[model samples]
Target chain A: MPPTSEPSTSDTAQPTDADALQAEVTRLRELVGPDEAAYTSLKIELWAARDSAFGAEMAAGELRGQVKVLEGQLAQANRNRRWMVERIKAPLRRVKAILR
Target chain B: MARYSILTPVYDPPEDVLRACLESVARQTFQDWEHCLVDDASTQPHVARVLEEYAAKDRRFKVKRRAANGGIIAASQDALELATGEFVCLLDHDDLLTKDALFEVDLIASTDPSLDYCYSDEDYLSPDGKFINPFHKPDWSPERFRSQMYTGHFSVARRDLVIEVGGFRTGYEGSQDYDLVLRVTEKARSVRHVAKILYHWRMMPESVAQNAEAKPWAYEAGRRAVQDHCDRTGRRATVVDGVVPGVYRVQREIEGEPLVSVVIPTRGSSARVWGVERCFIVEAVRSLVERARYTNIEIIVVMDAPAPAGVIEKLERLAGDRLKIVWYDKPFNFSEKVNLGAAHASGELMLVLNDDIEVETPDFIETMIGLIQEGDVAMVGAKLLFADGRLQHAGHLYNHDPFHAYFGYPANHLGESSVLACQRETSGVTAACALVKMSIWNEVGGLTPELAANFNDVDLSLKIRAKGYRILWTPYAVLYHFESMTRIPTVNLDELKVMRERWATPLKNDPYHNPNFEPLRDDWVLRSR
Candidate 1:
């Protein structure tokens, strides 16, 4: 009774700091829920986004590979066209037969 | 006793020549040889009497008279078909063989059991039986035989191979022997040349060389023979001029080291100092020096005026002792400058390089030199291309139609231009980057300074042809040429006038110059054009 004669402002501020800490703890508990279904749904959405991005990348790579193959085929066709014109078709039809 | 069936086709041969040939056959040391004489409907009574007498007297000799004249080639074929000996020998009724001809041939064949054919040297004789000159040949190596058939040795071949080739083509009479030899050599397991005089070739007045009228057909026959040989061997055969009487073989050897001299003639433009041209020279020289498999070379830079001090210093520092500067302060003449450079060359092969041109490959010199090393080739030209990789020159041809001129064509064509590009006997080459034999250059007296810058190469080529040497073009040897870089002002009025005058003189004066510019005339192009 002799030591606690007057009430101090520090005792009132100490309870307010405790109240703010309790509110932060309540918000953190809401973010990290104890329910398994909510956590699993969020994890599935993130995984789907990552999988879609990876699939898009793989499709682009396949398209590039196909373009290179087509270019090679086009070049070969041009060569064959020139060869047939100069060596085969023209020689057979236009030029006088060498046998004669 | 090994018997040789000698096939002789008679077509109104001179009485004295026929008798002499018959006497030679009668006097042969090898008595086992038989004669199969086919009379191809001779018009002369003396030929019939002589043939009848020989047939009646000797059982070894048989005469078959064709119902109608099928020509000399057909008669020879008929005689070849009738022959029943281990070896077949061909003899024209007008030519004589030595007494020991069969004996020597038999000895060579017997010694080498693998021998499919044997040939001996011959003496070219005049109609009066006077010796003109002896064509002594070297002993056979397959390489030498493939290089040139020097001995018109009147070869003795196996009968089966003769029959297999269908005897001989009728139209190839003048070169029937050549065609037969080429065919037999292709199939022959072994071939040997007896280095002795065993046959006599009669040089009659009516023969191809002596008679002006008979030459054209004879040349055509000779060309056909070359074509046939090329077909049979699966190798390209070019009909080049011969050092001797027969067709010169153009054989390519891929595996030998070549000695080369690179000649650069300069008048010292800014191009020589520092730029695209300088870079070209540096890169070409460096590539040749550093990367070439062929190590032996000498770089000759022929200068008309003194080069810039800076340029000289640069060349000295870069090349050190490998570069040799040949100074020519003479008049402005391209041919004279080249002659001056050639005079100082030490290599067995000489390359005339325009300083303006850059070599595309390190193997350019090697490829050009390889084509000419086949013994009979006098000169070779490389394929010239522009910086953009289009052809600048394949070879040269002369045109006399509108005016006397020289032209090159198929400027950017990728493949060969003509048969000449694949395998042909060309008229000449542009001297821009020509590879030639030093000996042949000396023999032909270099280039004429009068023609100088224009038609000088054509003049040199004509001289080579006159002496019976072939000028060749090789696609494998490639270079990039900024054409006529040294002739500055881009175009000179004085130079054009001079070139025209110079070209006209050679066109007028050269006797060997194709009258209709036939050298430049391509049959294929003519048909298309």
Candidate 2:
């Protein structure tokens, strides 16, 4: 509500280097704010991509373990083939013998 | 005038083959049947003589001759006119029926008095009379039937139903049986499958049993028959030739663009895929954003608390407004995370995907959306391939234990019945890349939390099936599943016990799989006997 005793700057003469330098700094700040934000966002995106690729690598390692388990199961199955065949064909052999 | 009438349209087959066919019918253990033979103006003189001898020998052998040369369809119609039995069994003139063929049919029909259609397994008979290549068929796969006529030989049907479908359409001469079966099943009250090899299709030089390509025109006829069936059944789909000759692909048309909620649960784990270290969730979202052809989808990522630093920022940057992040602070339970993500989704269809999956098919979402919209379908799963381009999951087989069908097979290898490439009903499909109807998901109570990781998808599948819903696996939608890359693949004893307790009967007897297949095997290999 009270009036100040300080004089207005617009009416003063303009020859100070500090004032020009300050004006230039204000202008540059306004111009570079969006570019800086964009650059930071792009960096985050790049990091995310790298993390995704790392996830895939981790997946490959896990796949190796799972594949090994499957190979073991397959080998066991092959080993039991003869036993299974004999067990399954016993009844058929009995029936054929009766018919003969 | 008989209990059963056997219809055989005779062409100029070899005299020995014709005599063998007649002898097989004459030696039937169930003797209350008549053989209706129609010679289609055979140019060879031996055909008539053989027919005359068979008719003279057995009073049950009814023979007729067409004055002009008519195709199989016309001959079959003439034979149909001569039938005066309650049921008709189709027999190729050169093929031989097992002695117990009619006996098995009679027994099955006696047990189920309301049976309208019946079929059995068959094999090819070599020139030296050795049986080989037995087609052990599933119980009653209606969807698989639409793909191909797996129930090819020894088809028995009620004579009234056969006559009602106008016998066989003239246009479908080569594939007349396929058309007839499709029409017959549409109105069938109960269809029974005799899981026995009752027919032996002779692999003659000109026979389809010798080589599928012997009659290429038959496949086109089959395609038209499928298309006509789709039209009659009010299915909005286009039938195209499948990877092989007799198989077909049904590309359904989506009614409207419905919103799809893709729920992915992850801990923001990192993996080395092709020597590149990357975040699994971020790459999964990136693939959806960059590769998918369908646009009406939202990405719901359920992330664990204390999330990896840059993963969330990257997902936001990639999916933008289409992304919704839900925090999971509890211990890692895949079922709970998926249920949490599903609870927050706002779409008609819920797509449960793993963090390591990369979309390979551009129209995978659209295809899944169309399939899940079917009235009887509860869920649909995608064909998954490993990082090395080997098959990871075609579907789940639960003959004894739950396992992936054709796991680690070549990516392009079609399974025993071309099942790996067709969209057909299955006992279960993996939740790694499955799209389910939102209402059906809620109805089945989602995945059972008790099954933290192992058998969760199998439990969900059984729950859905218990509600009389079908689970379909489609090869049309494909994805690269770098499985076990994030979470270690370990099975807990408690989870296995719970699954056994809940789904003991279905786990033991999977109707989608044939009994002749060896139990506890992923590949459809026959039993040792």
Top DockQ prediction, candidate number: 2
What's the lDDT for all of these models?
Answer: 0.66, 0.89
Instruction: Write down the TM-score of every candidate.
Output: 0.45, 0.86
Looking at model 1, residue B119 earns an lDDT score of 83
Worst 10 residues of 2 chain A by lDDT: A57-66
Winning model by lDDT: 2
Best by TM-score: 2
Candidate DockQ values, in order, are 0.01, 0.08
Q: Alpha-carbon error at B300 in model 1, in Å? A: 14
Name the lDDT of candidate 2: 0.89
